[model samples]
Target: MIAASDLPEVIPLFPLPGALLLPRARLPLHVFEPRYLAMFDDVLKTPQRLIGMIQPQDGEDEGLAAIGCAGRVTGFSETGDGRYMITLSGISRFRLGERVEGFAPYIRAKVAWEDFARDLGAPEQDAEFRREPFLRLLERYFEARDLSTDWASLREAEDERLINSLSMLLPFDVSDKQALLEAPGLPERREILAALMEFALHAGDEGSEILQ
Candidate 1:
């Protein structure tokens, strides 16, 4: 459990559009590119073992989105071919401050974590989230996409887990996923997820455009 004060001021930034890592969620990444392989190696030697997952803007070279989630490297393996398979466990969301240039081969950023201190603790199980509506919309979206999921496990997941998992796994556009990442809390994120799923079900093959 990382405390707010323990958060690092600088972290390596991995800019992957449409990939999100909410607090307490886990995201697996395959690191093969030389720059990122270097980043992975550097993180392994650091005590914090942290990385920031952010989304790069689609056009105009406007740099990264203001917010991103910081993940701790909880699982790691180095392949004989010099690749890395790693799992990052989300610690908290952070607001980007300024880009620092000295990291070499990869980007690093100054981050602010005060706004997301709440993420350092587990979400309350009894939080006021509308589960029935969310589940209904999720089912509809899944059916439309011809996607199969483990219903039993999804049904038993805690609210925070369910919402965060769906937000990360859903095929929404990069902007929509960022909305979920930047949402104020679990209930609001749940609401946005349901709304996005409902919209997707109605938009047919063009649903991603609606999310944009």
Candidate 2:
């Protein structure tokens, strides 16, 4: 029941490549890095417990993408070896604003939440989603990559969950994941996702043809 106004103006940033966290989706992470462990330590002290899950720009590891999602630390535990097991439940996507300069080992930035205020609302729906056709495409794509998934689970999931989870779990390029994150709504995200899967399938077909 959190609102945009209740969100913190600034949040600690975790720059990870190929990781996508969309609104209403949960992402589990293993925190072993020293700096990130410190980041979680500080984040736990805050009331909101939000962390900006961002991607490092495609080519360079240092610069961050312009858009990123902020996820609340909804689940957390510490392992015996000082590592952390945490789950982030996405709240909203925000535009990266000014980077806060400080001595903190992790990155923190001032974020603008107005553009994605819808993310704070109820789960989104894609009325135009064609579940059967999309599942067919997904099967071909997964078969090409030799990947396996639970069919029953996918069939039972709502539109947003199915698409967003695939967008996060798929082995698409880092830029692809960022594009999915930045999509304005569920429909746009679905379009980009289907396109990406189709392209992968086509590319695989071409590769097979060449080897034949």
**Best-matching candidate per TM-score:** 2
TM-score of 1: 0.92
Model 1: residues with Cα > 4 Å off, grouped in runs: 59-62, 205-212
lDDT of 2: 0.92
Clash total of candidate 1: 0
Candidate 2 residue spans exceeding 4 A from truth: 58-61
Write down the worst ten-residue block by lDDT for model 1: 122-131
How big is the positional error of residue 113 in model 2, measured in Å on the Cα after superposition?
A: 0.3
Please give the clash total of every predicted structure, in order: 0, 0
Provide the TM-score for each candidate, comma-separated. Answer: 0.92, 0.97
**How would you encode candidate 2's per-residue C-alpha lDDT over 40-148 as one tens digit per residue?**
9999999999999999974434689999999999998889999999999999999999899999988999999999989988889999999999999999988889999
Question: Worst ten-residue run, lDDT, model 2?
Answer: 55-64
Error of 2 at 53 (Å): 0.6
